[model samples]
Target: MSGLLALLDDVAAIAKVAAASVDDIAAAAAKAGTKAAGVVIDDAAVTPKYVHGFQADRELPIIWRIALGSLKNKLVVLLPGLLALDAFAPWAITPLLMLGGAYLCFEGAEKLVHMFAPHADHEIEADFDTRDPARLEEEKVAGAIKTDFILSAEIMTIALATIESPSFWMQAITLAVVGTFITVAVYGAVALIVKMDDLGLHMAATGHTSGSRALGRGLVRAMPRLMAVLSTVGTAAMLWVGGNIVIHGLDVTQLWAWPYKTIKYVATELANALPAAQGLVQWLVTAALDGVFGLILGVILIPIATRVVGPAIAAIWPGKST
Candidate 1:
């Protein structure tokens, strides 16, 4: 009887420790996820464009495909890749981050060019107009997943940095929890945002109350404009975030400090100018400067990417340049 009671005590103690570990993981994940909120927002903002022109019925399916790809990017690819990188070549993280940032800048600038010069369509846009629907959808999903991989890398890295130096298993668990929670939160929000128009249509059609129907009609009318605005915001966000990442990476790598320092100095001066709204002014100035730099870098890289890199990839991997 005494031995059984002792064994029961040991089991109870083990259960308590397990419960505590779960609580710790949850808290750590939340904190780490919060630190990556900017990238999370950018991820959500950037995704809607991938589903922009699809049929109403196809919209949710497209989003689901992209969401699944995003989950794979984070959990299957990034989680393991980042963990290995963190364990082995910690110094390489910043440069790789800068590479991802440059890609975002390139994508954002490409969109800007398309906006300004509709005659000069990108390969993807051309494919969309000319190719089979299935092919276009495949390309769109692939592109979205590629972009998500970059952003997810940043998010996971940020989360890893935010978490304190716990045990190896603890760190891994926290990162996994953070990655899963963020993936669900971000894509879930994206799903809702994309389906909003459909919801509005349903409400407009079926609502018994006149006010509810009227509100639904307003929602339906507003969706197109909202989507357009969201696309523009997404583009700007890509630039802002991409530039910010590169600048910080440059600072971290000790390659160039001037851009980050100059931006801070200028933002501080502007904040002083508008002391009443100093925080807001500072943030705006910093973001504007980052975006401008991102655009410049992207524009510079465009020709190099198109003329040199694209051809190199095409030569190596036949159908991939498009």
Candidate 2:
């Protein structure tokens, strides 16, 4: 009986340790996931377009396909590459992170330009217009997956940077959690967003009560506006997150310090000025400054990306680029 009690105590201790590890993993995953919020939001916002114009019955399947592709991109392709970088070239992570930040800025800036000074990408439009339905669907899915790879790379790298774990296994597990969670959350949201109108329509048509029908009508009417809001939010988030990343990266590398220092100073002053709302004031000011810096950097990069980078990629990859 004494021996049995001792064994039970040992098992309980093991259970306690296992529970602690699970808690640690969850905490790390949550922190890392938040660091990649901009990419995740933009991902959710961008994916719906790939399913647009598809038959109603095909929408969920298409989203499922893209979601699977996104998962594969994150896990199969990016995860190992990132782990290798962490293991062998740890010093390169910051520079690569900043490069990802610059790409985010470029994307955000391009979207801003398109919103205000829209110009058709005749090649893209022509390609879509000329392709048969099946071919177009395939191409759209392919393009979306390609886009997801870049975004996934950014997400994974950001997650990696934020993870505090030094153990390789812990880092691996945390990244896997972040990747899987973000993929599900983003694509699941996309699925709901795309089908919302249909759901609204069905509710409106079949609801037994006037209030339910009215709510359904409201939902249908609200979708387009919701999408517009989502796009705007995603763009702003990209710029804010991207600029913040670059500023921090620059500070880390001792390449440029003033931008971050200046922002901190301003935020501190604002927080001091509004002590009652110190945290909010500081965060809003910091985010605003970061966003402005991002906008400026993005605008500057726009010409370089379009005039030089796009042309170079196009030369090498032909229709696969730009």
Candidate 3:
């Protein structure tokens, strides 16, 4: 009887330790995930567009496919690469992060330019090929997956950097958790956003109450505006996050400190002035400055990317430039 009681005590202790480890992983993942909010938001914002022009019935299936691709991106490809980096060349992480940041900035700035640029019929026509529906879907999914790979790389790198754990296994577990959680959260939101109109239509058609019908109508009306807002927010987030990464990378390299310090100083001043909203003021000031820096860097890179890099890639890859 005493032996049986001792075995039970040992089992109980082991279970407690397992539970504690699980909690630690959860906490670490949540913290790490928070650090990549900008990319995550942009991911959620950007994914819905791939479903555009597809049949309504295909939207969820397409999103599911993309989500699975995203999962594979994080788990199969990026996770192992990141672990290798962590094990062998941890120093490379920051530079890789900065590169990803520059990419985000460039992408955001390019979109901004296109938004304001005079419309060109050729550009529209170029994209309006009479491809088969299935082929077009495949192409769209492929493009989205490729884009997701870049964003996921940034997210995982950011999360890896934010993790405080010194244990290799702990870091791995935390990263896995962060990756899975983020993929699900992002694609789940995309699915919801894309289907919202349909949901609203159904609600409008079936609602017995006037208020429900009104709310349904409101959702339908609001979706376009909501999508626009999301796009704008996503652009801003890319700039802010990208700029932050570049500045921090520079700081890490001991190459530049003035930009970061100056931003901080100004934000501090604003915080002091608006004591009631100190945190908000500081955050806004910092984000604005970061975004400005990102915009400038992106603008500079735009010509180089389009004129130099684009042609170079086209030359190398022939017809596979995209």
Best by TM-score: 1
TM-score of each: 0.96, 0.83, 0.88
lDDT of each: 0.88, 0.86, 0.85
Stretches > 4 Å off in candidate 2: 1-23, 34-55, 120-147
Cα lDDT of candidate 2 equals 0.86
Candidate 3: deviation at residue 150, Å? 3.5
Q: Against the true structure, what is every candidate's RMSD?
A: 1.4, 3.4, 2.7
Model 1 clashing residue pairs (backbone): none
Worst 10 residues of 1 by lDDT: 121-130
Candidate 3 lDDT over 1-322, as tens digits, reads: 9999999999999999899989999999998999888679878877787787788998999999999999999999998899899889988888887887888788778778878873533443344343677877877788678768878998998898888888888888899999999999999889899899898998899999998898899999998888778778777777887888898888887789888888999999999999999999998999999999999999899888877787799899885543
Range of the 10 consecutive residues with the lowest summed lDDT in candidate 3: 120-129
lDDT of 2 by residue, 1-322 (tens): 9999999999999999989888999999999999889678778877786777788898898899999999999999889889998899878878987887787777788778877765545553556763488878888788788767768888998899899988888888899999999999999899999899898999999999999999899999998788677668767877887788799889989999999999999999989999999999998999889989988999999889878888899899996554
- Candidate 3 whole-model C-alpha lDDT, 0 to 1: 0.85
Task: Rank the models by TM-score, top first.
Answer: 1, 3, 2
- Per-residue lDDT tens digits for candidate 1, residues 1-113, read 99999999999999999999999888998899999998899888999988988888888898888888887888888878877888899888899999999998998998899
